[model samples]
Target: MHHDSLHALLVKEKLSLTRPRRIIFDLLLHKDPQSMQVLISRAANKVDRATIYRTIELFERLGIVHRLNIGWKYKIELSDLFVGHHHHFHCNQCGATHTLQANPMLETMIDTVAAKENFSPRSHQLEIHGLCGQCAGQPA
Candidate 1:
């Protein structure tokens, strides 16, 4: 989606259309999922670390994006295109993150396990870390 559209949506959601916020949101929306470190490095300006973290926190709370607990920090990406629950796969070697379509069977299994253990499952985040296809084929 265009940055303009994203900005409009944020405005509609009663969020301030600040330059740093817009830039961060647009970058995450257009590019693949990335960790906080990578995003900071690639950002056009030397945005303060606190600023980026706070922006991400606001965006996540507003349902504009979702965070996947993976790697050293976390991976974040646009949440509009994603629906329902699903698993995420993060490559340790390449630091690439991708979403796996939600599996009803897996969801059911998790539910059953929770019930059996008498644990209240609020939510779950799963990641299979390994070398992706490209990285696995290349000489290590």
Candidate 2:
């Protein structure tokens, strides 16, 4: 999404488009998923850790981003409201994360299971944690 549109979103939410928030938003806008450490280090204007953490918490609370917990740590990215429904391949060895495209077969399986259990499903998330290509000693 455009930065202007993001600004408008903040306006609609009656939230201030603060400099730290804007920097964090732009970071998530381009990348897929990023760790807090990566975000703190990559922020252009050197936003402090406490401010970035608070911004991330705020975004998650507002449904603007999804927090994918990796053990005690986590990564943050734009939620499905802004992006498409998909899964994640998280590298256990190196902590790298790669996006997995949405699969129709998986959707079919989920629907089948829900029908069998008579369950009403609203939303779901999947994260496959293992060694990524590079960590597995192959091309990434």
Candidate 3:
């Protein structure tokens, strides 16, 4: 996305484009999505942890990023790329996350469960954890 488009998104979401928030959004746009610790470490200008967390929270609310529950810790990433629906797989060793393009089986399972439990499923997120191919073959 272009800088102008991103800025428009912030405005459409009724969000202010502060320095820290812009940097964080730009980092996610250019680099791979990362955890807060990684983002903070890569920041050129020192940013408070609280500010980072707050920006993340606001971005999440605005649908600019998705806060993924990757089991051990929270992982966030850009979400506007996907058209319909998708899932993710995270490498436990290298911390790399890949978007899964298809997962009909999982969707069916969720639908079945919702029907059996008589609960309406508004939304759901799935994160599978494992070593990526490179990490799996590496010697520890």
Best by TM-score: 2
State every prediction's TM-score relative to the real structure: 0.70, 0.85, 0.71
lDDT over C-alpha atoms for residue 109 of model 3: 91
List where candidate 1 sits over 4 angstroms from the true fold.
Answer: 1-14, 46-50, 80-84
lDDT of 1 by residue, 72-113 (tens): 577788774434466777777877776787788998888889
lDDT of 3 by residue, 1-140 (tens): 45566577788968667788778877787444577778878774667788888888887777778877765777778765423467788888877888776578888898889978898887787777888889999946
TM-score of 1: 0.70
Task: Enumerate residue pairs that collide in model 3.
Answer: none
What value of lDDT does candidate 3 attain over all alpha carbons? 0.75
Count of residue pairs whose backbone atoms collide, per candidate: 0, 0, 0
The lDDT per prediction is 0.76, 0.84, 0.75
- Rank candidates, TM-score, best first: 2, 3, 1
Total clashes for model 1:
0
Ranking by lDDT: 2, 1, 3
lDDT at residue 7 of model 1 (Cα atoms)? 71
Is candidate 2 or 3 superior in lDDT? Answer: 2
